[model samples]
Target chain A: MDTFVQQLINGLTIGSIYALIALGYTMVYGILRLINFAHGDIYMVGAYAGLFLATSLGFAANPSAFGFVVTLVGSMAIAAAMGMAIERFAYRPVRKFSKMTTLITAIGMSLLIEYLFVFFFEGKPRSFPQLLPNDNITLFGNATISTSQILIFVVSMVLMVILQYIIYKTKIGKAMRAVSFNLNSAKLMGINTDFVIAFTFALGSALAAAGGVLTAQYNPKIDPLMGIITGLKAFVAAVLGGIGNIPGAVLGGLLIGAAETMVVGYGSYIGIPSTYRDAVAFAILILVLLLRPAGLLGSNVQEKV
Target chain B: MNWVKSIIVGIIAIAILYVLNAAMSATGFFGIGIDDYQSRLLVFIAINVILATSLNLINGFTGQFSIGHAGFMAVGAYASAYFTVTHGKAIETSLSGLGETVASSIVLLLAIGIGALVAAIAGLIVGIPSLRLKGDYLAIVTLGFAEIIRIVILNIDAVGGATGYQVPGYANFLWIGIFAIITVVVIHNIVKSDAGRALISIREDELAAEAMGVNVTRYKVTSFVIGSAFAGVSGVLFAHYNKFLSTNDFQFIKSFEIIIMIVIGGMGSMTGAILGAIIVTLLPEILRLLPAIQIGETTFQFADLRLVIFALILILTMILRPQGILGTTEFTDFFKRFRRADKPTGGLE
Candidate 1:
């Protein structure tokens, strides 16, 4: 029972990060109808940005709540600017072309970011500087949770709430919704669709960056290619919850994360080795796609003639 | 008369292949030597042509977006490699009376057959269920399936698992070139046939095709399976010729490279696929020849930035020529247009 609780906690902590990243995928996909494959690399960039800020600004030398906050916000700002820049340059030019073209461009953007980073920073993994004092607190029945895990959960929840507030209670969020509903209509109604799209990318990229930083906190190893698998799984989560649905993305993330941890935790009894952990997300995805093609929370719209 | 012409063409093709094979051998034909590197490049181009054209059948002609092609390729490569490693020696020994070349050729044929059959079955299994979804969903599902296939292969120890698999090299440039040609001819004929029209219609408008009584599911699955089978064939040729099998070689990036080929060459254009295959195969080598730049204390190698340059090229291509270089037009069509001075037609519309 304790192990199950422990696994569940670990799963949810990771799930929250997936949810943060999934939000970005879901948002970009909502308005643009493009996967924005480079969004994952944006997450990696965010962690790297945070690392640079922490080290250069002397925050890594003395860990504090203020230091962590500054590093988090600083990286988020950097990643947001990058997101907007990417949309303006790479994506904007190809936006008018076929869906395949935009997708390919996005893929190209992803490769460019990954390899450029590899070219500059090298492919070796770097340990992210610990930004918080580490400690474990026992809950009950020998179950324990670490400080970094708690930070991931708390920070993600706070950011998600802020995101919710922005979407529901702000004018730009309203514009974002209008644009996603119909780009042409939104433009006709005097909403700046381009700005909205860029804002969406900024918002999504910021959230993803947050996820990246949070993940680094929990597991400090940061690498250029780390985003590929995590980003893919998060994209899967977005799809599993219905791609464009915001709440659905969160639900999908948690479900996927829990399922992955459970596979690692209990799969040995079912003859599944822990090495199959990476495959677990995809397996669940296929099953979900087969049963619920529109996703769990996605509405099935009738095909128009 | 048609049968006689085709027979003659067949004989000529075989003769050309035989001469080409001899020329590429260590001891050259007429003392003119083809270097190992050049021959290897030619062989890879042939394999990639098969891959691109087959993938084009599914993604371009059929309008079904499948990015899991390498998964099918891996299946074929590993299955055939396993067969060749375990039973190949026995089969070769039994057929040795026919001569060494004939015995090895027989073994390779059997391996290719097994590879194609197994990959086709995998295609059927994956295609039947996943083809029901549309567009991005389909793409993600295919990607997921490919990852799953890779992970599963990674776990299986009999095929050397993560250590990589070694196999007998039963394939040569001749066999690979023949299969590449066969794949192109078969796929081109399919695109030109009534069923090809059905596939094109599905790509253009799925609902309209369904309204017109096209068995949408069947044709989609059929094209997908055929594409996967050809991918499998390429895998077989690749495994036997390369004499090495690694799951790393069949990763998502490889699938993306195949997509890049068809995209750059012009999707739905057979010649474009071939052209794209050649360029993609050669681009890296060309990039490797680039001079290094010395700046201050650091020397930057252009070879190391080949992938970065490649990505930039892909992005630029998508922006500048979103419809691709050929835009669904055949290479011969360019000549026809030049002769007649007529407006070129036939693309997505």
Candidate 2:
């Protein structure tokens, strides 16, 4: 029972990160209908930016709550700018073309980001400096949780709440929703669709950056290629929850994360080895896609003639 | 008369291949020798042509996006490699009386058959269920299926698991080249047929195609299976020629590379696929020849930046020429246009 609870905690912690990233994927997909393949790389860029800020600004040497917040916000801002720049340059030029063209451009942007990072930083993994003091709290008999894990939960929850407020309460948020509903209609209604789209990218990128930094806290190892698998899994999560549905992305993320941890925690009894962990998300993805094409939360719209 | 002409053409092709093979061998054609690297490049180009052209059948002509082609390729490679490793020597010995070259050729043919058959079956399994999904959904599902296939292969100890697999080298440049030509020809002919028109119509509009009495699902599945079978054939050639197999070779990046080829060449254009294959194969090697730049105690190698360059090219291509270099037009179409332009006075017509 304790192990199960512990696994759930671990899974939810990972799931929260997936949710954060999935928000970005779902948001971009909502408005632009493009997968935003580079979104994952933006997460990586966020972590790297945080690393740069933390190290260069002496925050790594003197870890404090204030320092962590500053580093997090700074990285988020940098990633948001990068996201907007990417949309303006790589995506906007090809937006008028076929969906395939935009998709290919997104893929190209992803590769460009990954390889450019590899070129600049080398392919080796870097250990992210510990920003928070490490401590474990025993929740029950043989069940424990760490400070970093708690920090992940708290920060992600706070950010998600902020995201919710922005989406529901802000004028720009209304514009975003309007554009996503129908680009042409929104344009006719006097909404700046391009600005809304860019703002969506910025919001999504910032959230993904937060996820990256938070995950870096929990697991300090960072690498240039880390985003590919995590990003892919998050995308699967977004799809599972019915892509373009915000709440659905969060639900999918949590579900996928819990399932993965459960498999790792107890899959040996079912003849599945731990190394097959990477396959778990994809397997779930195939099953979800086959069973629920509209996703769990996404509504099925009739095809127009 | 048609049969006679086809037979003559087939014979001439075989003769040309035979002479080309002999020339590319260790000795030389006359005294001009093609080096190992050049021959290897040629062989890879042929294999990639088969891959790119086959993928084009589904992605370009049928307009069903499939990025899990490497998964099918891996299935064929591992399946045939296993067959040859287990029973190849026995078959070779059994056919020893036919002479060494003939025995090896027979073994290779059987291996290719097994590989293609197995991969086609895999295609059927993956395609039928997933073909119901449309556009980006289909793309992601295929990608997931490919990942699952790769993971499953990684777990199986029979094919050397993660350590990689070794098999007899029964493939050569001649066989790969011939198969490449055969694949392009078959796919081209299919595209020119009534079914090809149906596929083109589906690409243009799926609902409209179904309204026109086209069996949308069946044609999509058929094209997928055929494309996968050809991918399998390429895998067989790759495994035997390379004499080793690794799951790393069939990763998602490989699928992306194949997509890049078709995209760069012009998706629906057969000759464009061939051209794209050649360029993609040669681009990395060409990058290797670039000089390293020395800058203030640091030397930057252009070779290391090849992938970066490749990505930049892909993005630029999408932005500049979204239809790719050929835009659904074949190289032969250009020649026909040129000939018509030469005689602008309406000569024959």
Candidate 3:
């Protein structure tokens, strides 16, 4: 029972990260109907931004909870700016082109970001500076949680709550919904669809940035290529939750996180090595795509003939 | 007659390239006259050409967004690497000197065939499930599938596991050149055939093609298998050329690079693929000659900034010319406009 609880804690910790990243994917897909392949790199960029700011601003010179907030907020702001810039420069011009073209451009953008980081920083993984002092607290029996894990869960929840409030209770959120439902109709109704799209990118990127910094706290290792697999898993999570649905992204993230942890903890009895844990997310993606293309919570839409 | 024409076209194309290489790199018919860097670049160009042209079949012609092509390449490279390391050794030793070269060459061809076959099987499995998906969804699935392949390769110890494998070298410019020609010719022939039309129609509109009895699933699978087979052939060439095989070599980035090649060349044009291949292969090497600067005690290398420059070029190119350099047209099509004054508006549509 303790083992189960321990596994659950671990799963939720990572699952929250996946959820945070998936929100970005889901939101972007909601508006543009694009799988922004570069969104994951934005997450990486966010983490790097946080690292740079934390180190350069002397925040990491001494460990304190106040410094952590500064790092987190700084990363989010920088990532949001990056997200908006990407949409304005890379995506807007190709918005009127083929979906295939936009998709390729997204991929190109992903490569560009990844390689640019690699070019400047080299490929070695850097140990992220700790902004907050860490300690472990036992919950009950052997199931204990670290301060970093607690930070991940609590921060992600707060962000999600804030996001929900924004999406549900704000004028811009309503405008976003209108634009997603019908771009031309929204424009005709005098809403700035372009600005709404950019806003969605900003919101999504900020979440991904949060995920990035949060994960860095837990893992403390940052690399340029770190986003590829995590981003992919988040994509799977979004799909699992029923893509384009906000609540669904969170649901998918937690479930995938739980599934992956369980597979790692207990899969050996079934002759599966823990090394194959990386594959679990993709396997789930394939299964979800085949079994429920619209995802668990997604309503099935008829294919246009 | 078409086969004959294709063979002629292949020979002419290879001959032209051979002369060009002779002048550019001195890697003509025989001898080790060419510098190592130039030869490596030339061989890589041939390999990239194979990858891009084959990818165009599924991506450009059939309009299936497959980003897991590196998965098939990994399958081919590993399979052939295993074969050459195990069976090829015996063939190499059974003959003497020049006879050994002849025997190994034949054995290498057989090994490449096996590699292609295995990769084709993998492609069939991937393509079947993936045929139902399209566009962005398809790209993600293919990518997921490729990552799975990489993980599996990493686990299996026989092919060296994560440590990687080193196989004997058997590839030269001539061999890669031959296979590249074959890939281009065979794919070009298929693209021009009646089946090719069915494939293209599916790309244009799957429902309409199915309504017209094009058997969309079958042709999609077929194009995938053929393209995968050639990717395998390129893998075989890559494995033997580099004489080393590692799962790291076939990462998702490789697939993206191949996509960029076709995208830059013009997705739907063969000549564009070739042009794209040459540019992508040579760009890094060409950039390596950039001047290095000294800042106090530090020597900053402008050469190290090539990938950054390369990426900027891709973003800028996409923004400026999203249709690619050729824009779905061909090189010969341009000259043909002048040759025939009466039929001016016609080109490969």
Every model's TM-score: 0.96, 0.97, 0.95
Query: For model 2, how does the per-residue alpha-carbon lDDT over A232-267 read when each residue is reduced to its tens digit?
Result: 999999999999999999999999999999999999
Ranking by DockQ: 2, 1, 3
- The list of candidate 2 runs beyond 4 A from truth reads B1-14, B338-349
Instruction: Answer with 1 or 3, whichever has the higher DockQ.
Output: 1
Q: Which parts of model 1 have CA positions greater than 4 angstroms off?
A: B1-14, B337-349
Query: Can you list each candidate's DockQ?
Result: 0.77, 0.80, 0.70
Better of 2 and 3 by TM-score: 2
> How would you class the docking of model 1?
medium
Cα displacement (angstroms), candidate 3, residue B37, comes to: 2.1
Ranking of predictions according to TM-score: 2, 1, 3
lDDT of 3 by residue, B82-132 (tens): 999888877777754668669879878988998999999999999999878
Candidate 3 stretches with Cα past 4 Å from truth are B1-3, B14-32, B93-98, B294-299, B341-349
lDDT of 3 by residue, A176-200 (tens): 9898888899999999999999999
